[model samples]
Target: MSETIHTGGCQCGAVRFKAHGDEFASSICHCRMCQKQTGGYFGAFATFADNKVEWSRGEVSYFVSSNIAKRGFCKDCGTPLTYEWHGDGVSLAIGAFDDPDKVAPNKQLATKSRIQSFDTLHKLKVREDTYGVEQSCVKLQNFQHPDHDTTTWPKE
Candidate 1:
């Protein structure tokens, strides 16, 4: 079972959040709106009660994608963070989690809208981490936020 509390944020460290308690649902959505928002084939999300999430840093700007739903993203960096439905509770982006594997999805939705490429993703070539170093492309420094939270970001 996953931990009771999980934390994560945007790629730029502009936003951070903590999710507490069990999720109502966890799924990968293949809807067009989700795809366009994430600039990917699908959007993975974990549904939780409104009170379950606490914003530990930065605020999110919401885009009204449809009459019944709105998308929440980092206002500064435009990292897609959430999806809220009219009647359903909020859903946090799986990619934004510090440990996405821990909160693995048990379901998938809007499968008809799923692109053909997604079904064949497993056939793609797998590369090891050493590939970057071997190609002399490994970064000497990483400016992105670490997986865990910190007292201050972008430490000097």
Candidate 2:
């Protein structure tokens, strides 16, 4: 079973939050919309049930980015926080967590439009000792499963 986990905030610490519930699947979305939203090649997300999340410090500003998903960010710092699907539940931005090491991106979604730079990003190796021992050294690329797709995503 998965246990409750917590984390949040922006670079300056103006916004904060506490998320609860099991650590669900993490994913890297390479869709153009996600790229524009994050200003990066893609966005990293850690999924969770809606009821499992709570805002302990600041209110989040939500934008309906798509017909099926709503993106959330910190009102104070414009920190991209979450991409919640109307039917698929919430997927928190991995960077919002206090320790992003706890989550691992499992799959590359919307690979059809993935940028060439994304290849370089993937080549960057994650050094285990770089972050610390308490946090595991597992890389998103290294994670594997027999039933990969079925286990990592929620059914809409």
Candidate 3:
């Protein structure tokens, strides 16, 4: 495991935070709720131990996205930031950091909702299950295919 890494804030620099410990699970979620919350085709998250995270710059505003989960964002820019689950620790948005490359997504969840346009972004092919566990693709380029295989994802 890599040593804990510190990440910088958003565009205005009002929100700075640190994530300690190796990122355990990283994923892209294409669920409708995630799409609505993030205003994107999918939401990317990196999980970390609750005790390992420290907010250094700004306080986060939260929305109770579910009975057991709360979604956090920067109060200043409204950047969809973190997802906190009671007793489960936190998941931070990969795009909110200064360097998202430090972490790699282990799988993709709710792939059924993945945008079709994503398939064309790169030539990389993805080997995935319906559960969205991608065994082959590593870089973001793989998500460019508009015709991604979503067979393993749960159906509505």
Q: Quick one: best lDDT, which candidate?
A: 1
Model number with the top TM-score: 1
User: In candidate 3, what are the lDDT values of residues 1-156, reduced to their tens digit?
Assistant: 667674744444456678877756788888887788789888888888888788876688899989988888878677788878888678888887667877667788988778888778687778564554454344435312112223222232
lDDT of 3 at 2: 65
Residue 43, model 1: lDDT of 94
> How does each model score on lDDT?
0.89, 0.73, 0.72
Error of 2 at 147 (Å): 34
CA RMSD of each candidate after superposition? 2.5, 12.0, 14.1
For residues 41-155, write the lDDT of model 1, one tens digit per residue.
9999988888888999989889999999999999877899999988647899999999998778899999999999999999999875574585565546667888989888778
> Residue 151 in model 1: shift from native, Å?
1.0
Q: In model 2, where is the ten-residue run with the lowest total lDDT?
A: 144-153
Which pairs of residues collide in candidate 2?
Answer: none
Q: What's the lDDT for residue 121 in model 1?
A: 97
Candidate 2 lDDT at 52 equals 75
lDDT of 3 at 106: 74
